[model samples]
Target: MKESGRKQGAASPCAACKLLRRRCAQDCVFSPYFPADEPQKFANVHKVFGASNVNKMLQELPMHQRGDAVSSMVYEANARVRDPVYGCVGAISSLQQQIDALQTQLALAQAEVVHLRVRQTASLSNHGFGPGSPNSSGSPSSKLMGSQVKPIFDMDMVVDQASLGESMWSC
Candidate 1:
């Protein structure tokens, strides 16, 4: 007997239809987003929001927006499952808090950098590198001794983080 046109290696029903124990129609709503291999994804969505609601929402949307809507629903459903109280909002809030803390640290570090610069300028002024031709004590002998005093911070080692960030923007 000749074989029927039906391919022997046919694809199985999608997660939704399989979980619901129903035959997957050719135009099944969940087929595109939820494949047969990954039943957990559909289960997650189903657990959070029933399949009926998802189907209705998908049917109401325009074809162009459906894919994005499905992806968003899946992501939101996943987040909701993970975080019961706040879901995606909790994740966003945590990220924002981290950003705020980092910004505060950056401000402190920048202030310290400015302070170091001022102190360095003052130190240089104490030596021959400043105005009024060297030390405030008023002795040329102090100028000879000033050369022995080491700089607070090596100028070559000091990096201006703000300028570096601007350069990264240009790149």
Candidate 2:
């Protein structure tokens, strides 16, 4: 059966009593529950419990400022990403252009090969070297005879011949 009225000489009130705006019981037991030395710690606790006021203050700030702040951060991130993407796209476009040019060159080369083959066939026909003709160089016997001729002469023989030709010309 403790006293129900407020006690005398109370230093400070409990947090709950302060929040509720009520008279404290002046009990020393609740003092150990909170830090007594630092007033900022108690203030922080009060602010955390009373977050509605803080939120209202933040909401009162201009919308454009918040939007611009967010947009600036996003713009910086986008700028960082853009250079690499642009470089990759440029490289791909360059490779595609090179491939297109190579394809055109290949088509031209193929056309030249076909034209040369036609010309060779026309010349062979005019020379009386049609498929079964005896004078045709395309014959297997002619090819075998060509293959048997050794075109790779010895280096010593080439040097001797070159020297002999030079001496004869000098004389």
Candidate 3:
């Protein structure tokens, strides 16, 4: 038993303990999440959040939550490493801009729908059929014979054309 214990110490330490220059206990908090083979994972986490803090967090959390916590830490660390300043905030801003653009497009589309309905109703009244006439399909109210009523503006195509990056916020 004593010989086995000595051999276990000789075995390679887990990434966390190796990076921190300490022996990895058999029950180390990092051992399950970070293996010895993936040193870079530990290095990234260590750089963003010190080893001691990470260890403490893992220890405090329940076993089921530790995996998700580790994954989140790695993702946040990568984003911070890439941006340094803005980090996740940059991503959120970009998404919000897209949402706003899409909403504006939706409003414009709704207005166009109303305009077509009015034009259809006028044409139908001329032909002795009212707006709610059972003779017509709801879908074709916007179409005048074979002519399709095109949208006044295409929201997605326009948003993609414009670069809503950091420079957009200046104005």
**Candidate that would win on TM-score:** 1
- Residue 43 miss distance in model 2 (angstroms): 42
What's the C-alpha lDDT at position 113 in model 2? 53
lDDT, residue 120, candidate 1: 72
Give the candidate order by descending TM-score. 1, 3, 2
With a 3 Å backbone cut-off (N, CA, C), the pairs that clash in candidate 2 are none
lDDT score of residue 99 within candidate 2: 78
| Stretches > 4 Å off in candidate 2 | 1-85, 137-171
RMSD to native, candidate 2 = 26.8
Least accurate 10 contiguous residues by lDDT in model 1? 1-10
Distance (Å) between predicted and true CA of 112, model 1?
Answer: 1.0
Candidate 1: regions farther than 4 A off: 1-9, 131-171
- Supply the global lDDT for candidate 2: 0.46
TM-scores for the candidates: 0.70, 0.33, 0.64
Strongest candidate by lDDT: 1
Q: List candidate 3 segments past 4 Å from native.
A: 1-12, 131-171
Each candidate's number of clashing pairs is 0, 0, 0
